[model samples]
Structure formats: C-alpha cells, structure tokens
Target chain A: MESTYLFLTTVTIQSSMAVLFATLGEIVTEKSGILNLGVEGMMLMGAMSSFAASLYFKNPWLGVTCGLITGAFFALIHAFFTIGLKANQVICGLSLTIFGMGLSSFLGRFLIGKTGTRFLIWHVPILNKIPLVGPILFNQTPLVYLSYIFVPLIWVLLYKTNIGLSLRAVGENPTAADVTGISVVRYRYLATIFGGMMAGLGGSYLSLFYTPGWKENMTAGQGWIAIAMVIFSTWNPFRAVIGSLMFGGINALQYYFQASGITIIPNYILMMLPYIFTLVVLFLINQTEGAKRKLGAPASLGVAFEREL
Target chain B: MIEIKVKQRIAYPKITKFFTPFFALFFALLFGAGLFKWVGVDPLKAYKIMLSGAFGNFYNFSEVIVRGIPLILSGLSVGLAAKMMLWNIGCEGQIVMGGVGATAIALFASPYLPNYLVIPAMIFSGFIAGALWIFIPAIFKAKWNVSEIISTLMLNYIAIIWMEHLYFGPWRDPEGRGFPGSAIFPDAAWFPRYLGTRIHLGIFIVFIVTILIYILLNFTKLGYEIKVIGESELAARYANIKVTRNIFIVLMISGGIAGLAGVGEVAGVYHRLQQGLSSGYGYAGIIVAWLGRLNPWGILSVGIIFAGFMVGGDALQLNLQLPSSLSLVLEGALLFLVLAGEILPKYKISISWKKLSKS
Candidate 1:
C-alpha cells in the first residue's frame, strides 16, 4: 500500500510539472490583461524545439533553453499582432496554435522515433532519506525540482511585488495604468514573454524529462488544460498547484489503471475523465453568481488596449 | 525616436477589402517558399509541384472537390456561428459524433428502413447527434456565461475518445478478421456519387445548406437579432432579443452543420465509421471561415482553396518526401498573415521618425 502511495504521489508530481509551469505563466500573462489562447501551440513548438536541440547539442539543458526560446519566439508573433497591430486576440491566438502545431510537426518530423539527452532521476543526498515525502519529491528529475522553485517564485512575483501591482493594474484597467505613468504596452509585453518562457519550460519538461523525446502533438491537450487550470486557480500561482495536482492525479490514475490492467474502469473512460472534469470545473466556477464575481476573469482579459491621443 | 500612429478609418476602399484575402494568400505562399528553401527544397519547383498536383488533371480536380465537400460544411458551420460572435471550435468533435450517429443508422437501422430512406435517416441522425454533442457547451455558454471556447474544446477530446471506444470495443467488426471498425455500411446507406469520380451528393447537400443559412442569416428577424447580439449583447437585450435562447439555437444549428460534414465523410467518402474519418477538417474550417470573412459564398471559395492546399501538401509528401504538415504550416501562416492584414482597412497606419509632442 505504501509502495502504491509512493508510486501514485511521485507520478502525480511528474505529471503536474508541465501544467504547473504553464498555468503559472498564463497567470502572469492574464494578469497583464493579455489573453493568449495559444499556450497549446507555444508548448508544442517548445517541446519540438527542445527535443531537436537536445538531440543536436547532446545536452538536455540546451534543449530546455531552446524550448523556452521557441515558446517566447512564438509568443512574440502573437505580441506583434495583438499588442502592436491590435489584432483580435482570440483569432490570433488560434492561428498561433495552428502555426505552432504545424511548424512543430514539420520541423520535428525527422526527429520522430529518435532518442535524445534526457533528464534522469537524481536523488538528493539527505533529502532522499525523509520518510514518505522525500522519496515522492526528492527522487525525481531536475525539472520536477525546478517546478517547486517556480511555484513559489511566481506566487511572490504575482502577489508581493511592485511589478505584479502594475501587471494587475494594467489588466484590471489599462487606461488607469497608463494614467499612473505605467507603460501598459511594456508591462504587457514583458508578462506575455515571461508567460511564453514558462510554457516553453513546461514543454521542455515533457520532452527532456517526463515522457522524453520528440513526438508529434506530444503536449496533447495539456496546454489547454493549463488554460483551464488558470481559471481553476482563479489566477493565483499558489492555487495553481492544487489545479495542476488535480490534473496530475487524474493522469496518474489513468497510468495506474492501465498498468494494473484494471477492467473496472475502461481505459477510454479514464482518458475522457480529465477533459470532462475540466468542463465540470468550468461549469461549477460559473454556476454561482457570487463565485463569478469573486473569481472573475481579469476585467479586460481579452480586450485590446489602445491609448487615446 | 520613431512613433507609429494608427487612426481608425472612417471609410475604407472597397477594393482593399476585396483584395485582402488574395494578398494574404500571396504573402503566405511567399513565406511558404522561404520554409521550402530552409528545408533544402527548391521553392519554385515545390510551388510547381503543388500547383500541378492540386489542379493538373480532371481526376485530381475531382478529388479536390471530394475533399472540399467536408471543408465547405465545416466552414459553413464555423462561419454561421461566428456571425453571432460564437467560436465553435468543437466542430471536430461534432464531426466525429456525426459519423457515429450516421454509423448507428447505417449499421443497425438500415435493415428495417427502405433502401431510399437509409441515407436520409443517416444524415438526420448525424446532424442531431452532432447538435447533442455540443448541447452541454451551449448550455454553459448561455446560462452561466462560461467561455464556450474552453468548454467546446474540452468536449472535442471527449467525443474523439468516445468514438475510439465505440470502434475499438463494442462496434468492432468480428467477421472481417478482428478489424477495428464496424461492418461495411450497406449499399442502401451509400451516398450517390458521380460516375468515374469520388464526388458524391454532398455537393448538392452543402449547396442547399449554404443557401438556407445565407437566407436565414440575411433576410430573417432572427438574423437581425444575431447581428445585434454579436455587435453588443446589451443592445440586443434592449431590442428585446431572447439572447439565451438565440445562443442555444444558433449553436445547435452550427453543431448540426458540422455533424453533416462527418456524414459526408462516412456516407459519401469512407462508407464506414473508421479511422481517418476526421483529418483535421474541423480545425481547417476555422481558417476557411476567417479567410471567407464569415460569408457563406466566400466560405465556399476558401474551402476549395484549402482543399487544394491539402491535396498539394499530400503531393509534396509523395514527390519531395516532405512532411504533409507543411500544408498546415501554410494554412497557419495564411491565417496569421490575414489577421495582420485585417488592421490595414480598419485603421490607417503612419510612421514618423520624430515623436509627436503633446498633440
């Protein structure tokens, strides 16, 4: 039973890393009042680029960096269109996703079925000796530990910093932020780029550590789940842990069921649960009138901001 | 310092609006050539291959039409919904369920129904099933003001999983050596096809549906409400439009149309609900709808062009050994370019080296 618990908990953390990174990134982006719906696309490009880079360079760290760069680069196109040209955020984001998926598939085609430098499990010295929690947390890849650092860092950056204040101000009311001598464009761009980098890092985690190696459409709806997680967390990085863990738990359960060859719950139904669960969460979040206000989206989430002359 | 000033256009030239999509295509092809060059393929040669592959012969052109049938239906589905400012990205799922729905009729009900009635029943059931598939998302959007984008997208994965379950589990054909698909759909369920070509009755069906939607969106009171609601939901409420009911109705119709695309795939093309039923036609519909500017007639033209792209992309794979995903790259690039170009007619942009002081 303890072994099973360790297995589930460790696998849960492993699965949660990607979503956690992406959700945290999106939280920052949305906080700055830009709704980028291209997380899936950005993540795909990140994963593809990371995998390809790792294979070429023979270093996993380089792959991780490339993934983040690719994600930010994709987000840059979105920024230029939505932020610079003032294009429709939703449509542009969709295009970004399509672009990412296509580009990744095309570029990574050669990398299919090939292995690359992957992050292996590294046990920390004394930390690995801790009873239950250590084995579950300490005995994992570098990316899992990196995720632990980011969750708190993002929380502090969001809720306890001047930069976070300006981001929130811009999202809540761009006009107000502009009057206070804040460059809404600059803050929004930075936040969006930062968000993209995080999503890229998440993608790297998938390719360099979690599943390891490049595969077409490897992110496989986790990017979308991260979007749902943003809402699930109510834009709080700290709360994002809960949302990611919930998703990771679902993934771990699916893995467990398949591994045990359990017929009690069909494999397909288990696969469907994550999506259905996301829908249900969205429904519940919006169902209550009070909850809608309390856990509302950023006031100007999808709206473009143009300063008045 | 340089400053770029953008001012909203009071009136734009009609020619710019008419030529924007073409220009977007030109830019996308230009970028596509750059991608080809990057991948060690000759740009001009690649273009020549793609063009010839798509339209070199009557047979190829017919195949393009066969492909365009689904594109048009899904495109129309997306375009109609977008008219009311709704994004029906779940058209993919709707298409899958539509196949399942039609398959149910073809596999089970065909024996009881007369030969003439089977195809019609499959079409009807497919449409209804697609609508039902989207029912949850529509309700969430209408009642709770939830983002239909996420809800609809989530349902897409669910629908695909369910379809996979059906084919891989209970619906698996036993007689055909344990094949992972249902028994062949009876001849009664087979859609009427043109001689010596894969083209089916879907052409006429799509035409009728397009015209019906065009008339409904233009000449009708509900059309006016949809327009007003799209412009401003507050204004729609002030004008006594039943906003919630309209949302539900429009989404159901949109989903139903997308489902018909699935029917075409199963009844008109595959003749069985199996793998390759959805080849990203639903997602491709988004590009068509946007490229067509959400106009039914425009969607028809764009649908054909996109189908040509798909065929050409396959040709690239066959001839150059390039990934067919290159076509998707072109489609995505086209969408991005079109979106960037949209700023042109809407706003007049001017750049100056010196920053303006005060006014």
Candidate 2:
C-alpha cells in the first residue's frame, strides 16, 4: 500500500510537470496581455524538434535547447504577426498552432517510432534519503526539477520584481505602460518568447522524460489543458501548481484504473475528465464574482496593442 | 539603422480587401517554396503536381467537391458565429456528435421509419446533437460571460472522446470481425449521389445553406442585431438588442451547421459512423471561415480552393512521398499571411534606413 501510495504521488508529479511548465509559461505570456492560443502547436514542434535533434546529436541537453529554440521560433512568428503587424491575436495564434502542428508532422514523419536520447531519472543524494516526500520529489528528470524551480521563480518574477511590474502594466494597460517609458512591444515580445520556451520545455519533458519518444499530436491536448490551467489558476504561477497537479492527478487516476483492471468506469470517460474539468473550472471562475475580481484576466488580454499616433 | 513608421489609413479601399487574399496567397506560395526547397522537393514541380492533381480530371474535381462539402458547412458554421465575434472552436466536436446522432438514427430507428422520414430525421437529429453539444458553452457565455473559445475547445475534446466511446464500446458491430465501428448504415440512411462520381447531395445542401445564411445575415432583424453586438456589446445593450439571446441563437445555428458537415460524412459519403470522420475538417473550417472573411460566398469559394489543396496534398503523399500534412502547412501559412495582410487596409507602413553621424 505504501508502494502504491508512493507510485501514485510520483506519477502525479511526473505527469503534471509538462503542463506545469506550460502553465507557468502561459501565465507570463498572458500577463503581458497577449493571449497565445498556439501552445499545442508550439509544444508539438518543440517535441518533434527536440526528439529529432537529440536523436541526431545523441545529447539530451542539445535536444532540450533545440526544443526551446523551435518553440521561440514559432512564438516569434506569432509575435511578428500579432504584435508587429497588428493582426488579430486569436487568428494569428490559431494559425501558429495549425502551422506548427502541420510543420511538425511534416518534419517528424521520419522520427516516428524512433527512440532518441532521453533524460533518465536522477535522484538527489541527500534529498532522496528523506521521508516519503523525498523519493517522490527528488527522483525525477532534470525537466521535472526545472518545473519545480519555475513555479516559485515565475511567482517571484511576476509578483516581486520591477520587470514583472512592467510586464503586468504592459498587459493591463499598454498605453499607460508606454507613457511610463516601458516598451510595450519589447516586453510583449520577450514575454511571448519566454512563454514559448517554457512550452517548448514542457514538450521536451514529454518526449525526453515522460513518454520518451516522438509521436504525432503527442502532447495530446496537454497544451490546451495548460492554457486552461492558466485560467484555472487565475493567471497566478503558484496556483498553477494546483491546476497542473489536478490534471496530473486525473492522468494518474486514469493510469491507475487501467493498470488495476478496473472496469467500472469506461476508458474514454476517464480520458475526458481533464477537458470536462477545464469547462467546470471555467464555469466556476465565471460564476464566482470574488474569484473573478481577484483573478481577472489582464484588461488588454487578446487585444493587440497600438499606441495612438 | 532602419526606422519604420505606420500611419492609419483615412480611407480604406474596397478593392484592397478583394485583392488581399490573392496577395496573401502569392506570399504564402513564395514562403512555401522555401519550405519545399528545405524539404528537398522542387517547388515548381510540387506546385504543378498539386494544381494538376486537384483539377486534373472530372473525377478529381468531383472528389474535391466531396471534400469541400463538409468544409463549406463547417466554414459557414464558424463564419456565422464569427459574425458575432464568437469563436466556435468546438465545431470539430460538434461534427463528431452530428455523426453520432445520424448514426444512432441510422442504426436504431431506420427500420421503424419510412424511407422519406429517415434522411430528414437523421438531418434534424444531427443538427440538434451539434446544437446541444455547443449549447452548454453558449449558455455559459450568455449567462456568466465565460470565454466561449476555451469552453468550446474543451467541449471539442469531450465530444471526440464520446464519439470514440460510442464506436469502440457500446455501438461496436456484433458480427463485424471485432472492427472498432458500428455496422454499415441502412440504404434508407444513405444519401443520394451523382451517377458516376463520389459526389453526393451534400453539394446542393451546402449551396442552399450558404444562400440562406447570406440572406439571413444581410436581410434579417436578428442579423442586424448580431452585427450590432459584434461591433460593441455596450452599444448593442443601449440599442435594446438582446445580446445574450442573440449569442445563444447564433451559436446554436453555428453548431447545427457544423453538425450538418458531420451528417454529410456519415450519411452522404461513408454511410457509416467510423473513425477518421472528424479528421480536422472542423479546424480547417476555421481557416476557411477566416480566409473567406466570414462572408458566405467567400467561404464557399475559399472552401472549394482549400479542398483542392487537400486533394493535391494527397497527391504529394502518393507521388512525392511527402506527408499529407503539407496541405495543413500551406493552409496555416496562408491564414497567417492573410492575417498579416489584414493590417494593410487599416494602416500605411513605411521603412527607412538611416546612417548614424560621427560625434
């Protein structure tokens, strides 16, 4: 029973890491007031590029870099169109997703069913020796550890820094930020690129650590779940941990049910829990006025910023 | 150093709007050439092959029409919703449920119904199923002002999962050699087709719906209210337009249209509910809707051309040994380029290079 308990806790953390990274990334992006709906596509591209690059270079770290670069590249396209060209953010973001998905599928065809360099489980010496908490947290891929650091790091970056203040100001009121000498365009571009890198890192975690291979649509709506998590957490990085864990818990539950020979609930229904939960979360957030006020979306979210000339 | 400046246009030309898509296509082709070259395929040859493959013969053209049927419907679905600035991203799920609805009737109730009633009943059920699928998100958006985009998108995942469950579990054909789908739909459920080609009655359905939607959006009171709401909800409210009710109505119609696309696949083309029914038609519809600029006529034309791209893409897979997702890449690129081009009419942009003077 202790073993099962340990297994579930570890699996929950392991499964949630990808989404956790993406949620934190999107939190930053959305905080800059740009609603990028292309996380799924960026993640796919990142996964495919990282897997292929790692396979070629035979180095997991290089693959990780490739993933991050590819994600940033895709996000750059979105930024160019939505931020630079002043196009509709939603349409540009959706196009990025479609383009990313298609490009990844086109490029990654050769990588199908092929294994590459992957991050193996590394246990920290002193940390792994602790009680039940130690093994579950300490024994994970480097990406998982990165996710753990990112949650607090992003929280600090968003809440405790002047840069975060500028970023939030840009998202909330770009005109006001522009008046204050903050470059709305630069802040938005950086925030978007950083978000993309995080999403890419999340995708890398899946290809390198979790599933350990490249597949079409491999992220399997986790990117979208991450987007929903950004909302579920009310755009706060710390609360994003709860949202990601909840998704991870759902995934672990599905895994456990299948492994335990449980037939009471159908497999597809179990698969649907995350998406259904997202809708429920959105509904709850919408219905609760207090939650809405405290954790409302940035005023400029999804609206392209254009300074009056 | 280079300095760039942008100024809003005082008078945007109608002619520019007409030509923007063409220019965007030209740019996308130029960009696609680079992608093709990188992938080691000759761009000219690829383009030639695609053009010929799509418009090669009468049969091929008919196939393009067949592919366009769902695209046009789903495009119309998305376009109608976009008229009110609502993103019905869940059209994919709505399409699946439409197939499920049609399949349920085809498998269970066809034997009890008259031949004439089967098709209409299937159509109605399919439409209702799609509407019902989106109704939850619509109500939420109307009542509590939820983001329809995310909610609809989430429902899309649920709808597809539900459809898979139906085919793989409860509705699996008993004597079908353990295949993961329902039994073949009855003849009564099958839609009428042209004599030699795979083209079915869906083309006519798409045509009528397009015209009807055009008329509705341009001529009706509800259409005027939708346009007003799309412009500004605050203005809409002040003008006494029931914004909430209109949103619900528009989404219901949008989902119903997308559902019709699913019905076409099962009843008109496949004659059975099966895997690969959704196959990105709903997502493709978004590109079509946007490329068409949410106009019914534009959607019809763009939907056909995009369908040709898909047919041509199949050719690439066959002869060039390229992944069929090439069409998706082109579609995405085209949409992106067009989205960028959208700024042209609104603003005049200028770039100049400058030399730094020595101090």
Candidate 3:
C-alpha cells in the first residue's frame, strides 16, 4: 500500500509536468493576443525530434535542443501564415497541426522502438529525507526539476516585468498598443515562438523522460488538453501548474485503477473521465461570474491583424 | 526605392474562380514532387503511379469513388455549418454516434425487417444519432457562449471511447473467438453493392445530397440567412435572422450529414461496426471541406482528389516500399499550398528590389 501510494504520486507529478510546460507555453502565447491551436502538432514535433536527436548525437542535451528547435519551427508556420500572410488564424493553426502531425509521423517511423538516452532520477541529498514527498518530488528527472523552476520563473516573467506589461497591452488592444509605439506584431511573433519553444521543451520531457522512446503520434492529445488547461487555469501561468496537476492526477489514477483492478467500472469509462471532466468544468466555469471575467479571452484573440495605411 | 504591395483585385473574373482551385492543386503537386525527390523517388514517376493507381483500372477507379462518397457527405456537414460560422469540429463524434445508431438497428432489427425497410431505417437512425451528438455543443454555443471548437473536440474522445466500450464489452461477438466487435451485419442491413464491385449505393446517396445542398445554398432563403450570419453575426441579427435558431439548425444538418458518412461506412463498407470503421474519415473530411471552399460542386471534386491521396498511399506502400503515411504528408502539404494560393485572387502581390539611396 505504501509503495503504491508513492508510485501514484510519482506518476502524477511526471505526467502533469509534461502538461504544465505546454499549458504554460500556450498561456504566454494567448496572453500576447495570438490564439495558436497548433500545440498538439508542435508537441509531436518536439517528442519525435527530441528522441531522434538524443539517439543521433548520443547526448540528452542535444535532444532537448532538437525538441525546442523543431517545436519553434512548426510554430513558425502558424506565425508566418497568420501574421505574415494575414491568413485566417484558425485555418492556419489547423493546417499547422496537420502538417506537423504528418511530417512527424513520416519522419519518426525509423526512430520508433530504437532506444535513446532517457532522463534519470536525481535525488537531492537533504530533500530525499522527506517522508511522503521525497520519492515523488525530490527524485525526478532533471527536466522535472527544471519545470518547477521554470513555472514560477515564467509566472514572474509574465506578471512582474515591463515586457509582460507590454505583452498584455498588445493582447488587450493591439491598435492602441501600436499608437503607443509598441510593435504588436513583433511581440506576437516572439510570444508565439517562445510558447512554441516551451511546448517543445514540454514534449522533450515526454520523450526524454516520461516515456523515454519515440512513437508515431506520441504526444497523443496532450497538446489539445493543454489548450483547454490554459482556459481552465484562467490563462495564468501559476494557475496552469494546478490545472496540469489536476489533469495529471486523473490520468495517473486511471492507470492505477486499471492496473489494480479495484474498480467495477470498465477501463474505457475511466478513459472517458478526463474528457467528461473537461466538459463539466467548462460548463461550471461558464456558469460562474467571477470565473467568466477571469477566464475571458483576449479581445483580438483570433482576429487577423491588418495594418491598413 | 523598391516596394511591395498587395491590392484587392476589383474585377471578379468569373473564369478565374474555377481555375484558381486548379492552380492550388498544381502548387500542391509541385510541392509534393519536391517531397518525393527528397525521399529519393522520381517525382514525375511517383505522380504517374499515383494517378494510374487511383484511376488506371476499373477496380482502382471504383475504389476512389467508394472512398469519396463518405468524404462528400462529411464535407457537406462541415461546409453547411461553416456557412453559419458555426464550427462543428465534433463531426468526428457525430459520425461515430451515427455508426452506433445504425449498428443498433442492424443488430436488433435486421432479423425482422425486410431489406428495403432496414436500409432506410438505418440511414434515418444514423442521421438522428449524429444530430443528437452535435446538439450538445450547439446548445452550449447558442445559450452559454461556449467555444464549440473545444467542446466538440473533447466530445470526440468520449464518443470514440464509448464506441470502444461497446466493441470490447457487451457488444463483443461471442461467436468470433472473443473478438472485440459485433457480429457481421445481416444481409438485409447491408448496402447493395454494384456490378461485382465494392462500390455501394452510398455513391448515389452522396451525389443526390450534393445536388440538394448545392440548390439549398444557392436558391434558398435559409442559405441566405446562413451566409449573412457567417459574414457578420451582428448584421444577421440586425436583419432579424434568428441567429440562435439558425446556429442549431445548421449544426443539426452538419451533424446529420456526418452521421450519414458513418452509416455509409458501417453498412456499405464494413457491414459490421468494428475497429477501423472510420480510418479518420471525419477528420480528413475537414480538409476536403475547406479545400472545396465549402461549396457542393467543389466538395465533389476535392473529395475525389483526397480519395486519390488515399488510393495512391496504398500504391506507394505496395510498390515503392514506403510507409502509407505519405497520404497524410500529401494532404497536409496540399492544404497549406491551396490556402496560400487562395490569397492570390483576393490580393495581388508585387515585389521589387532596388538599391537604396542614402538619406
């Protein structure tokens, strides 16, 4: 029983961290007034390329870099079309997902089953002594620890800086921001690319640490769940941590139930839990006034920006 | 000084509208050729084999239409709802539910009903099932201002999982050595096949639906209302167009059509609601709907092209010793190029480079 408890906690943290990274990335992008719906594809790019790079270079660091570059590369397609060509943001985002998914699956064929260097657990000396939390929190892959640092760092970057203020201004009112000499387009591009980078890093954790191997369509709807997580977390980086943990807990619990054979309900019903939970949470959030105001989307969230002289 | 500018063309060249899609197709083929070359295959030869594989023999050509029938119906589902600016991404869920509904009839009522009665009953049941699935998102959008994109997509997971439950659990065929699928659909419930070929009457059903949708969008008042709503919801409301009702109406139609695709697959293609019943047709239909510019005639043609992508993927796998995922690559690249090319007629782009003079 004690071992089972420890195992569940570890699974929850590891699973949630993958979601936390992508959710945090999307929060940054959406906060900058660009709603990129290509997170899933970008995650796939990260998961595949990172595995490929880790294997090819025989270095995990190179794998991390590959994931970041590939993710940003896919996000670049959405940025170029939606920002550069002034295309419909939804269509552009959807196409990126398709293109990214197709390309990743095509390229990832050989990488499947071939093993790469995976992130190993590093137990901190003093922290390892903690009773219940040590095994789950202290002993984790390096990326997991970095995620803890990165989450709050991103939160501070988003809420406590001049750049953050400027980013918010652009999202709230791009034309007004333009009047004040803020380059809305440039900030959007940066925010989007950074978001993509974070999403890539998140996916790297999945391939490099979470599963430790490449597979076709491995990211497997986690990116989309991350999008919903942004909304659920009220588009705040800090709240995203809680949201990701909640979802990760559910995912972990489902596995526990399946493996333990404790529940009378079928495993498929357990599989349906996260999705049903999303719909219910979305409904409940919609019903509340404070939540509605807090979770409201940016005014120009999906509108194509056109600079008319 | 060198400058680049894009201008909206004033003239609506009627002939150009037809040719524009062809231009997009050409661009996609060119991009595909580059991809093929990168893969160490001759682009021209690959495309030749693709074309011939899709249309070379009677067998190949018929297979193309067989795949296209469901695409056309699902495309119409997306196109019609998109006309009202109601994004029904839940067509995947709706399609699955439609299959579930059709299969219920086939499994339960096939023993008693005559073939004619069973077929119509299954199709109608499928449409109703699809409609029921979409109604949730529509209501949420119309009343609570929820984003249909998220809700619909999430619903797809639930629908698929629920179907899997039936396949693996209660509905599992006992006679098939514990296979995770239902018994073969009775002969009475099966769609009539043609000329010793795999093609079913679903081809005719799709053709008729396409014609009807075309006339509805071009000549009907409801279609005008949908167009107005799509362009600007405020304008549609100002004209007293019952925006909320229309949102539900269009979604219902969209869901129903997608559901019809489900029916076609279960009855016409598989004859049993089992694993691999869809093969992602619902999602693929979205690409077709957009590529077709949400028009019936355009959908019919685009559906055929996408069908070629699938048929050709099979050929690539069998002949070229390559992965069948080439279809996905081709589809994704084709969509990107086509959407980019669409910008041409709307805005004429001009670029020039010259030496800069010091200020």
* Candidate 2 per-residue C-alpha lDDT over B275-313 given as tens digits, one digit per residue, 9 for 90 to 100: 899899999999999988899999999999999999999
Interface RMSD of each: 0.9, 1.1, 1.6
lDDT per model, in order? 0.90, 0.90, 0.84
Which candidate do you rate higher for DockQ, 1 or 3? 1
The CAPRI classification for model 3 reads as medium
Candidate with maximal DockQ: 1
DockQ winner between 2 and 3, please give it.
Answer: 2
* Per-model TM values vs. the true structure: 0.97, 0.97, 0.96
Query: DockQ, in order, for the candidates?
Result: 0.82, 0.80, 0.61
Off by over 4 Å in 3: A289-296, B1-18, B344-359
| Model 2 lDDT tens row, A226-293 | 88888889988888999889889888989888998887888898999989988898888777745665
Alpha-carbon shift of residue A104 in model 1 (angstroms): 0.3
